[model samples]
Target: MTKNNALGTNVIAQIGILVHDIEKTSQKYADFFGVEKPEWSLTDTLERAKTEFEGNPTDARAKLAFFDMGSLQLELIEPDQNPSTWRKHLDEHGEGPHHIAFFIEGMKEKIAIMESKQMPLLQKGEYTGGRYAYMDTFKDLKIIMELLENDN
Candidate 1:
């Protein structure tokens, strides 16, 4: 697994760019930056894989495909039939970097640290493999912070 120094702790980390179309954007980035083919996954597929989110016996669909851009991972998201965080972001703001996710082990502690600094969390809920927490730091910048935990 990849790791980086965040808030003085070694954390799983990546920079992300939110795009409207995955394949198109991935190609653009690859051509412009001379990068290789990107790794992709659908959010619905991920959600379906997680029993915690499934709750019922049904096929799950994901609206996201991801590309690894060196140290950064660019994620393309499209809202499927079901409601998703990506859907909400696209609905609210066009296409852009919706959030900067900092993956850490202790979500609660990370949240507390942010809260202590007076940064209010915008969304708090459960999704797919693990828990998630979000905080909006800027509206014009179209940036937010995401705390994610994966079962893996």
Candidate 2:
């Protein structure tokens, strides 16, 4: 098994929130945490990202923006339409923390380590020219933490 220093790892690179309304979600974050409002973009700019992330083409409908919190990035994602992932999550759990992401170098290795530790994966797949695996940790956490490995 590979030894990964807990402190050495960047545990939370980004956070995601699934919302039906970008404006509402952004406002909530800004007001609650005093986080500055983030910039929002449509599919035009996201086309270039179609092959860079782990999400599927259906994710293309998402509107994304970022705000920096120290070295971490807080990502606010609003799906373009109903019956989407954001919609599903919001319908089930309301607008809230959807996932936490860890940007790692070797996703396969990390996955192997997690599996060796007997951690069950909620989901795992390669997409958009990158690799991502999701695992559930602890009870009541609700949100899954995503392990992401980008080619870059």
Each model's TM-score?
Answer: 0.61, 0.62
List ranges where model 1 is wrong by over 4 Å: 1-12, 44-61, 115-131, 139-142, 150-152
Write candidate 1's Cα lDDT for 1-152 as tens digits: 33533334444355455566777877787788787757566543444443122123223344566666666566665545444455566667777767777665677777777766666566555566777666555643356777777667
Model 1 whole-model lDDT (C-alpha atoms): 0.59
Colliding pairs, model 1: 43-62, 44-61, 44-62, 45-62
User: What residue runs in model 2 are displaced by over 4 Å at the alpha carbon?
Assistant: 1-10, 28-36, 42-60, 80-85, 115-131, 138-142
- Write down the lDDT that model 2 would get: 0.64
So what's the TM-score on candidate 1? 0.61
**Per-prediction count of colliding residue pairs?**
4, 0
What tens-digit string does per-residue lDDT give for candidate 2 at 28-143? Answer: 77888876787786533334443222233533356877777887888787765533445556677877787888887777677667656655555554546686666654344556
lDDT: worst 10-residue window of model 1: 51-60
lDDT of each: 0.59, 0.64
